[model samples]
Target: MYIPELYKNENQEDIQNFIHQNGFAILVNQTDGKLWATHIPLVLDVNADGKQVLVGHISKLNPQGESFKADDSVLAIFSGAHSYISSSWYDHENVPTWNYLAVHVYGNVKIYTHEQAVNSLKKLVDKYEANSENPVRVEKLSEKTMREARGIIAFEIEITSIEAQKNYPKTEMIKTIKISFPN
Candidate 1:
């Protein structure tokens, strides 16, 4: 991700918070020299050793599932809120601009078997929605539905590294805001 100095997020906590707040993200992967992305809700996680991970599932019949190889890397893009800022908002005369926050997580996606995928989904659900008063209610499928649901694929991205940004530019008067990933 190309980030300007004023927009770089160097704080680990802020990056994690942004991901948690925006669970729905664009899961990006590459295959056959093609870039593929799926919009899905992701559950953010941290292991006992404090490594960042994400869990999500995709349709089994989808091209992404069919083409995913064991060695492919994936990216989860979590885009946060932004608002248009008129130069009038600034202390000095300047063109209108905007303010926003975004985070990109890159890692290798380890694909799981149907059973493993389902279990991962369960864990993801419990973790992401743990704080919600009204969390998403995953339907309990019947034997047949379970079998069909199993057809769906799931994967986990162990975040090997990260580069993130929090969008607050440095104006003439206001200093730039700094944020870091894995905060």
Candidate 2:
């Protein structure tokens, strides 16, 4: 992710929280000399060693995951709300541009096998389903069946670096520019 100084987000906690709030992300990897991308909901897993990992699953029929290996690097791009600001919106005659917020995470995609994928799924349920009022139901499958169903391979992306960028276009021509994130 190429972030200009004006659009850079420097806070680690803020970036992490932003991703959490916008967990639905686009995971990108390389395949056949081309970039493969998939949209998936992911959960963050933090380890004691400060090793931050991301867990997510893709359908067995999906070809996007084929681009990655245990040591291959992957990129997850998260997007938030965005809108177009018209020049007329400002009091002055300013050039129109778009305003948006986004974050891109770089990591190593470590493929999780049978047990590891199950653990990752459990953790994902805890993170996403635990908030519901009713108890979440998870299907239990035999090891052999699970292994066969592993067509949808789950993986843990150990985050190597995070690059968050906030784009705030200059709109002083009409309305006052206000950019603030909760403290």
Task: Report the lDDT tens digits of candidate 1 across residue range 33-59.
Answer: 688888999878764468778878888
Cα lDDT of candidate 1 equals: 0.73
The superposed Cα distance between candidate 2 and the true structure at residue 147, in angstroms, equals: 7.1
**Each candidate structure's count of clashing pairs:** 12, 3
Candidate 2 per-residue lDDT, tens place, 30-105, comes to: 8678788889998887754678888898876776666665238889999987767666678766798777788888
Per-model TM against the reference: 0.78, 0.81
Reference-based lDDT, residue 176, model 2 = 54
**How well does model 2 score by local distance difference test?**
0.76
Per-model lDDT: 0.73, 0.76
Model 2 off-target regions past 4 Å? 137-149, 167-183
Which portions of model 1 show Cα errors greater than 4 Å?
47-50, 127-141, 169-183
